[model samples]
Target: MINYNPKEWFTFIFRFHKADTFRKLFPLMIAVSLYGFILAYLELEYWSLINSSYVKNLSLMHSVLGFVISLLLVFRTNTAYDRWWEGRKQWGALVNVSRNLSIKLAGYLEDESDRLYLSKLIPLYARTLRGHLRANVNSDEISDLVEIDKTHIPNQIALRISGRIFELHKQHKISSEQLIILTKDIDVFTDVCGACERIKNTPIPFSYNVFIKKFIFFYVMTLPIGWVFSFGYFVVPIVVFVLYVFASLELIAEEIEDPFGSDANDLPLDTMCNNIEKHVKEILN
Candidate 1:
């Protein structure tokens, strides 16, 4: 994610970054300006478009079109943000649960080797889950931690950790109650994995995406015709600004919908995983 300092209002307005929306929308803004300029020149200078009732009536669309599309966009953006925030919360919960697991092992296991073995696996489970969500499990990062050959590496890692705790219980290193305590945190790990996987697999509906894209496309494209009467040649900048607002919202929703990825606006999974690892190691020590 792009980190920045909080700034005054003037600085906020003038700030610029390599935001995905800006890069994607720049060409569209230029195209909108050129489209508006052509329409204004043709209608006023050549006087061909000004004669048509359709050209004159285009601006009348703003009242109903603006209101309805705004409502739809509100729903669309909210749905996407909900998914993004939910993913963040799940990862945050995972970090806490991993620490909890480490603490339980430290208090229960007498042998330092057993505690170290199980506590180390907490961060490995997290890294494996990250790889699972991103669909790119790196062997080098996880090869030493688990068997690495299993297709479901995260779940198997969770099971292996649980199985070791059971072995510790069988050896009388920990009681049955300690086994339950450690298993409770293992359950939490699995729950978090399931929740994050749900977010990754279940996206917003296809119909909603299709409808929004079509509505925004035609609406922005028609703006040059709509506002050219009063603004004339000045419609170029107006259309560019208008397109920027609408398209930026659409792009923001798209960028945030899948928060698992390493996009600038995404949930910062790498940082969260690193924090989990650090916390786990500290508690295990």
Candidate 2:
């Protein structure tokens, strides 16, 4: 995620330089713009050729449709923001739950060795979660965080962690009663995982996505035509610039809505997980 700090105007713009990665695919934008321009030209040309009374009627309809599409875009942006914020809040909850689990394990396990074993496991779970959330389970950072023996940590490391937790419980390293208590806390983590996964895997429905895309194009298409009588060639850059603003904002909201992806705008899951490890270990140490 972009650091949440005050930035100079130039710096703020520079921060989004990475957004250029997406801008390279200008074909889609070009296609849309050409379609818009053609539609605008046809509207004006057809009206001039026909000299029908419908020109005034079409102007009224265009105004009404423009207002409606603007409202829909605003609503769409708000809904996307809500999803992104909720996903981030869930991870915030996970951080708390992980800390609580560590404290509970420390309190419940009597033997120092048992406590230490549980302590290590707690951070490993956090690391595992970070990797799994980002779909980087076999990553070196996760492996290093968990300190899994080379022989034991297989390619399917996520499954390995789950299995080992059960083994630890069954071996009486952690009592069944304690396991029951721990599982509740684990369930909180599980809920966080499920929620994040849901956001990552599911997007706004196809209909909603299609509607928004169509609306933005329809809105921008009308923009240059509406201003062309006054702005002429200036209409070209103005329309593109305005559309870029909306597109950039929409792109960011879309990126953050998933929160678990590798995008720069995604929630800092690895950083959060590492912070959890450091905090928990500090408590134990």
Instruction: Name the top TM-score candidate.
Output: 1
Per-residue lDDT of 126-150 in model 1, one digit per residue for the tens?
A: 8889999999888786667677667
Where is model 2 poorest over a 10-residue stretch in terms of lDDT? 152-161
RMSD to truth, every model? 1.6, 5.2
- Candidate 2 — which pairs collide? none
Instruction: Report residue 130 deviation for candidate 1 (angstroms).
Output: 1.2
Q: Write the per-residue lDDT of candidate 2 for residues 36-128, one digit (tens) a residue.
A: 566456645553423445433444655687677667767777877787788889889978976887787666555676556555666666666
Report the C-alpha displacement of residue 64, candidate 2, in angstroms. Answer: 2.9
**Model 1, residue 214: C-alpha shift (Å):** 1.1
Total backbone clashes of candidate 2, pairs 3 or more residues apart or in separate chains: 0
lDDT, each prediction: 0.84, 0.65
Deviating ranges (above 4 Å) for candidate 1: 7-9, 49-54
